[model samples]
Target chain A: MKTGIVVFPGTWSDRDCAHALLEVLGEPVRFVDYRERDLGDLNLVILPGGFSYGDYLRCGAIARFTPVMNAVADFANRGGLVLGICNGFQILQEARLLPGALLRNASCEFRCEWVQLRVEQSDCAFTVDCRPGQVLRIPISHGEGNFFADPHTLESLEANGQIVFRYCTADGRITPEANPNGSLRNIAGVANARGNVLGLMPHPERACEPLLGGDDGLAIFRSAIHALNRVAV
Target chain B: MTYRAEVFVTLKPVVNDPAGLTIRGGLHALGFESVKDVRAGKYLSILLDEADEDQARSRVEEMARQLLANEVIEDFRIELQPEPALAESRGGGPS
Candidate 1:
């Protein structure tokens, strides 16, 4: 499947995502600059991590207004598969493509470490290869990764199974200590109600190969490819 | 006429302010024992050229709603004022 990785000023993860998709997965991928309004034809769009717009005002706040985001919004509205990682997740929330907002970590520190994530649901386009309650090792790097939502919105997300992943222990136990960012309910990832769009705080692209530590993140990318193939068929 | 506006953006009451908590902790370390709480926020100064005060107010309000603040997790207040020199000139006009 063809994939597009969006690159915004101050976005540092585009190359990593490109390497994961092109070199590792052998998928056709290209970089889409933030100034471009046209996304062209692509099966998937990945918003990679980094301090977009230098994390000015707030993380992902200024970059959300870039011209390409309008196109991204339209693409998502058309039911295209969109994956947002790290600051990209923050951008998705700022664009209102996803519910909730990411706030400063409870520890008030920029945390960079490997964390375990439990797949909460596998029905979505991003996590179809993962089983419910399956644990995956991934790395997270960010300062404002704490996710928050209002009571009503949080309830709807839970009821609709929109929560896709949660911070968990290595052996798959969900506990407060496993929550590196103090995210509400330990949410590490979430999908839109339709499941076509997903935003997460972890860097799956950075974990796509054993050389990078582990290949646990490959399942997420492979799952998207499988979903796209299904659509093509 | 030009209007100057100061916008204040703060997190919602229920939202956790980690930075504010750290600041509070720092104050405590410095022996500010009487400090009850500290919540940090953002302040922005904006200048707008509009025909009237009402128009300027509306414009600034829209800016705050659309970009200056994310209302889902934060609240914003706008303080609007006519340019000081312009206000003085207007007063002088009636002299």
Candidate 2:
């Protein structure tokens, strides 16, 4: 599968993301400069983590206006698959591609650590390889990863099975203390209503290399590849 | 014409404001006991060279909606008037 990774001016994870897909998953990867307007031919797009636009004015405020985001929004509107990691998630929220917003961590400090998140739904392409309640460790580093949505929106997300992942204990039970960034309902990731676009603050690419200690993130990428293959069939 | 644009962008009240909170704490320590709540945001003054007052007001409003503010969380107001014949005031134009 061919994947496109959007690299904004301050994007720091473009290489890691590309390497994860190309070297680890054996998929062709391309770097998508945020200044470029064309998406060309690609099956998936990944907006990797970084302090885009120096995270000024708000985490994702400035980066949302980049030329590439317009194309990314269009692609996702047409049912194209997209993954947003860390600051990318903030960008998605700032763009209104997803509901709610991210606030500073409850402790008002940047958090960097491996968090165990339970797969809430496995039917979507990104998590199809995971079983409900399956635990996977991924790294999260951000100051504005605290997700906030109104109670109504949260309820709708729950009823529609849109809540895809949540921080959980090693045994896969969700708890307040397990919440890494004070995200509402312990949400770690969520997909749009159509399930084509996903925004999460965890850096799955950071865990794709086994030499880095774990390759728990491989399944998410592999699942997307499989989903695309199945659709082609 | 001197176009008056007042830009007010505030975080949604529900969203916590670390900057505001820190400032509040400082104010308390400095003995500003009367201050109850503080929300910090940017105030922009823009000078417009539109043909008429109405056009300038409309243009400033467009800017507020598109760039100056996030419609979801912030609110803004605009005012337009003829420029002062003597001196250029430094506040309330556009941002």
Best by lDDT: 1
What residue runs in model 1 are displaced by over 4 Å at the alpha carbon?
A: B86-95
C-alpha RMSD of each candidate structure in angstroms: 1.8, 3.9
Tens digit of per-residue lDDT, candidate 2, span B1-95:
55656666777786677668878888999999888888877677887677777788889889877777766556676655666641244444443
lDDT of each residue in A60-148, candidate 2, tens digit only: 88899999999999999988899989888888888888877887787668999989999999997899888888999988889889888
Global lDDT of each model? Answer: 0.94, 0.85
Question: Candidate 2: misplaced stretches above 4 Å?
Answer: B2-4, B29-35, B77-95
Interface RMSD of each: 0.7, 2.4
The pairs that clash in candidate 2 are B2-B83, B5-B93, B45-B94, B46-B93, B46-B94
Q: What is the per-residue lDDT of model 1 for residues A1-233, given as tens digits with 9 covering 90 to 100?
A: 78999999999999999999999989999899899999899889999999998898888889999999999999999999999999999999999999999999999999999999999999999888889999999999999999999999999999999999999999999999999999999999999999999999999998999999998989899999998998899
How accurate locally is residue A125 in candidate 2, as Cα lDDT from 0 to 100? 80
Best by DockQ: 1
